[model samples]
Target: MIKLTERQDKILQIVKQNGPITGQEIAVKLSLTRAALRPDLAILTMSGKLDARPRVGYFFNENYEVKRQAEKFLHQQVIDYKAHPIVVDKSTAVYDAIVQLFLEDVGTLYAVDSRGHLAGVVSRKDLLRATLGNKNLHELPVSVIMTRMPNIFTIRPDATLLEAAKKMIDNHIDSLPVVKEVEEQRNTYFLLGRITKTTITRAYLEIMER
Candidate 1:
C-alpha cells in the first residue's frame, strides 16, 4: 500500500466528508489554492483512496477502510517482530547443530563465521538429512551442508514484515535470518535476530485482538 503523507491524509478526510466534491471546493475548505490541492488529489486517486470522474468530482474510495487497515498490517516492520537468533559457529559439528535445533525448538539456525558474522543457514530438515546415511555426524562440520552466503535469503532489520512473509512464502521457508550489514566491502553481516511464520501469525493475532 502507498503510504500517505499528512496532506494526503487531510485530503482523504475532506473527500470522505464531502465526497463527489470538486478539487476547487476541497481547496477552499483547506484555505489553499486549487493548484495546491491538485497534486494531493492526483495522489489519492492513484493510490486507490479516491476515485474521480471528470465532472462529478472525487469520491472517497468505497474500500478505503479495508485498504487503510491493510496498510496497517503490511507496514508493520520486521524490526518490531524480530526475535533472538539461534546461532552456531560455521565449524560446529552437524550433531551439535541438531542438538541446538531440538533444545531451542527452532526450525532454523544461523551459522556465523569466526567474527560472528553470518556465514550460512542450517535448517532442521538439513540436519535430519545429514543424519540419515551418515555415521560420523560429530566429525562432519555443518558448513559442509549448510546453505552458504550469496545463496542464503536474508532480511534487513528495517524491512517490512509483509516483505519477510512474502519472501518466506516464495522460497518455501518458514523463517528468515535478520541481519545488519557491518562491512559493506566484504558484504558481511552480523545476525541481529530472526523472523518466522509464527511471528507473523502472532502479530496478526495481536492486531485482531486489539
Candidate 2:
C-alpha cells in the first residue's frame, strides 16, 4: 500500500533487475550523485521494499512484494478467469468419456443430467480405475463412477480466486466446477465454467507481469 515517488519507483526497478548492486553503481545508472540517491534508498529499505548489507549492497525484497501481490490478486473474482466448461452427458459411456477426456486434453470433465444441470464430476483416475478390471467400458455409465452432487466441491462465479485455489488444494483436486445455484431447486447447480490449476497459474503470471 506504499505510494512510491517516480524516482523511488525507478530506483526499485533498477535494484530489482540488477541487485545486489552498489549504491555507487545505481547512482551511475541514474546519473545522480550517491548523496542524492541515499534518501530514496533509506526510504525503500526502511519501508521493507529493499534489503541492504554492508558488503552485499542492495537487493529487491522479492518475497514481500510477491506475497503482497498474491494477496491482492487472490481477491479477484473467479468469473474473470473461468474457462468454458468441457462437459459430458451423465449417460455418456466410459469409453466415450475417455475419448472426450483425451480429445479435450483436460484432467476433469463435468457430467450433466438429461436436464443439462450439473450431476457429477468425472476425473481421469475415475475412468482409469473403472477400466482396470472391467471389460465392458461400452456399457459403463460415467455417472456410475462420477462423484455426485452435494459431495462435489464447487465454486460460484462470484467466488474469489483464493477460494477456488484453496478448494482445489485442500481437496487435492486439479479443477473446480464453476456453478450457479438454481432459484427454485436446492440441489441443482447450473454449470458455468471451470477453474483449474492452469487457470490459477495463468492469472498469477498475468498479475506478476503487470
Candidate 3:
C-alpha cells in the first residue's frame, strides 16, 4: 500500500461514505475547487483506494482496506521484533535440555557451539523421541538427536516478518532461529534471537489495536 497523505486519507473517508461520488462533488464537500482535488483524486485512484467509472464518480475500494491492514506487518523487518533466544550447548545432556525447555516455556531450543555460533535446533518432539525406551537420558547428548545445520531452517535479521510467518506455516513448525552470518566462515552463523508463531500473533494484534 502507498503511504497515505492526510488529504488522501480524507478523500478515502469521503469516497467510502458517498461513493459513486464524482470528483466535483467531493471537491464541493471539502470546500475546494475540482481542479484543486484533481491531484489527490488521481493519487487515491492510483493507490487503489478508489475506483473510477466512465460517468459515475470515484468509489472507495473496500477490499483494499483488508490489504492495507495486511501491509502493516508484511514489510516489518525481523531485527526490530525478535525475542530472546533460548540456547543450550550442543554437548548438553538430553535431560538438561528438557529441563531448560520447561524452564524457558518454549517449544524449541537452539544449540550453539562454544563460539556462540548456531549448530543445531532441538524441539520438544526431538527430546521426547530420544527419551523413548531410554532410562538414562542424562547420558544422551542433545547433539545426537538435534537437527543439525544444512537441515535447519533459519532466518536472517534482515528478513521480513511475513517471510518468517510463511516459513513457520509452510514447515509446520512453531519457531525459527534468527541468525547473523559469520564472516569468513562457511555454514556458520551466530544465533541472534528467535521468532515464533506467538510473536507474529502479537504483532498482528498490536497493529489492529493501533
Candidate 4:
C-alpha cells in the first residue's frame, strides 16, 4: 500500500469530491504548484487509489465510496465472484489432497463433512507441514490437520465489499468461505463460494473507475 502524506490525502479528498476537475483548479484551491501536484496525482493513480480519465477528468472510485446507494452496484456477495470451491471429504488422504492442490493451483481447500456443511479448511502450507516426516500419507486423514469449524472466517451474501476486505486484513488470511443459510435447516450451512484478496483488489479497481 502506498503511504499518503497529509497534502496528498487532502488532494485525493478534493478530487474525489469534485473531480473530473482540472489540475489548475485543484492547485489554485490547495495553494500548490502544478508541478508539485503532478507527483501526487501520479502516485494516487499508481496505487489504485485514483483513476484519471481524458476528458471526464478524475472521480472517486465507487468501491472506495462507503456511502450506501440504491443503485444496483457491486457489493460483497460470495456467489458473485467465487470460483467453484474445490472440496475434499474429511476422510480424504493427505497425499490425495496435495495432488488436488497442485492440480487446482489454489492456496487452500475446503473440507466438508458428510452432510455438506463446512468442517474445516486445509491450506497448502498445512499439507506440506504435515507430510514433512511422515511416510504414511495414504493412511493419514485430512481431518487430523485441518483448521476446524468455529475457527474459520466466513461472510454472508449481503455484506459490502469493504466489510469483507477489512475481515481479510484483520485475519491475515488470503481467502474466505462464503456460506449460505439454509431455509429449513437452522444449524447447517452450505458453502456457496469463496473470496480471495485478489478478488477484492480487482473488484475495488472496477468500482472505482465507475
Candidate 5:
C-alpha cells in the first residue's frame, strides 16, 4: 500500500469519524475546495483505502491496514539488518565450540574449513547432543555434528527480510547464513553474514515504531 501524506491522513480521519461523508464536506473540513481534494480521494479510493458510492460519500476500506503492513514487510531488505556471523573452524573441538557458543551468546555458529568457505552449520542442540556422556570433548571435532552444505539452508545478501523469515519458518530453523556465490567455484558460496528470527523481530519493531 502507498504511504499516505499528512493531508491524506487527515482526510481519512475525517471520513472515518464522519463515515459516508461527501467529498464537499471533507474538503470543507480541510479548508480546501472539493477540486483540490479530488486527487487524494481518487487515490485513496483506487488504492482500496476508501470506497465511494453514487449518492453516499466515502468510507474506510477494512482491508487496507493489512495490505499496508504486508507491503511494508515485502519491501524491507535483509542486508540492512543482517548481523555479523559467529564462526568456528570445522576441526575445532566440541568443547571449545560450546565455550564459543556461550561466549558469543548465539544460538548457532557457522563452521568453515581451512580456506574459509562455509563448510557447515552447528546449533546449540548439536553441541549438546555431541557432549552427552562424552568426556573427550577436546578431541571430538565439531564437524562430527555440524550440518553440511547440501543440508544447510542459506540466503543471499539481497533477499528481502520477509523471504528470510519464510525460510526460517519453512525449515524449522532459528537462523540462516547469508552468502554470496563464488565467481570461480561452481556451487561454493562465500559466507557474508547471518540473519535470524531475532533480527527480523527487531526489524519489525523498528519499522512499526517508525
Candidate 6:
C-alpha cells in the first residue's frame, strides 16, 4: 500500500497523460527543479508506481498497479460480491427466456432441474441462435440448446473474486454461476448467485478506494 503525496500524484498524472515527455518539461510544468523531481521519480519507480526508461523518460505502469491491488484484493470471495442470478427452468421456452433476459437485463441464465441441481446454462446468444431461423420459439425448450451439467462451468461461492474472474476469462463466458452444495441431498447444488466481470470490476473499484 503505497500512498502518494499531492506532488507525487501530480507528477504521476503528468507522466501518465503526457508521458515520454522530458524530465525538464515535467519539472517546468510542476514549477520544480530537475534535482527536486529526481527523488520523487526515484520513489515512484522504486515503489513500482512508475516506470522510467532512459530515452522514454517516465510512464505510469497501469498493469503494475492493477497487479499489486489485485494481489491485495485476491482474498475477497464470490459469495460476498456476487449479484443475484436470473434463473429459468430447463423446460422454459425460448420465447419466455428472451422475455426474462430482457426483463432482467442479464446476459446469461441458469437452468435448474426439479431436484434443485444445476441442469444447464443458457446465454442470450443461445436463445438468439435458437430463434434465428425458426418460428417455433414457444415450442423450443431451453434445455435443447443449453450447456448441460458436467459440461457447464461453475464457481463455488467461496472462490476468490480473482479465481472467478480467471474462470470466466478462461471459459470465454460472460458470467459464472455460483453454486452451494446441499448436505441434505447428494449431488445437489443450489444456485447461490452469479459473478460477472462487471460485478468484479465494480467491487474492485469500490473497495480499492478504501
Candidate with top lDDT is 2
Write model 6 residue lDDT over 94-195, tens digit each, in one string. Answer: 899999999999999899998767888898888878988676989888989898877877899889988998898888888888988777865567898999
Cα displacement (angstroms), candidate 2, residue 156, comes to 0.4
For all candidates in order, the CA lDDT equals 0.89, 0.92, 0.90, 0.81, 0.90, 0.86
Which tens-of-lDDT digit does each residue in 38-82 have in candidate 1?
A: 778888888788999998899988887787787788788998999
RMSD of 2: 7.2
Error of 1 at 18 (Å): 16
User: What is the C-alpha local distance difference test score of candidate 5?
Assistant: 0.90
Which regions of candidate 2 are displaced past 4 Å? 1-72
Give the local distance difference test score of model 6.
0.86
TM-score of each: 0.67, 0.66, 0.72, 0.62, 0.71, 0.63
lDDT of candidate 3 over 144-193, digit per residue (tens): 99999978889999999989999999998899999988999878999999
Better of 1 and 6 by TM-score: 1
Highest TM-score against the true fold, candidate: 3
Ranking of models by lDDT: 2, 3, 5, 1, 6, 4
Candidate 1: regions farther than 4 A off: 1-70
- What would the per-residue lDDT of candidate 4 be over residues 39-110, giving only the tens digit for each residue? 888887776677788867666666643443323344456567676788999899999999999999998899
What is the full ranking by TM-score, best candidate first? 3, 5, 1, 2, 6, 4
Model 5, span 161-201: residue lDDT tens:
98999999998999999998888885578899999999988
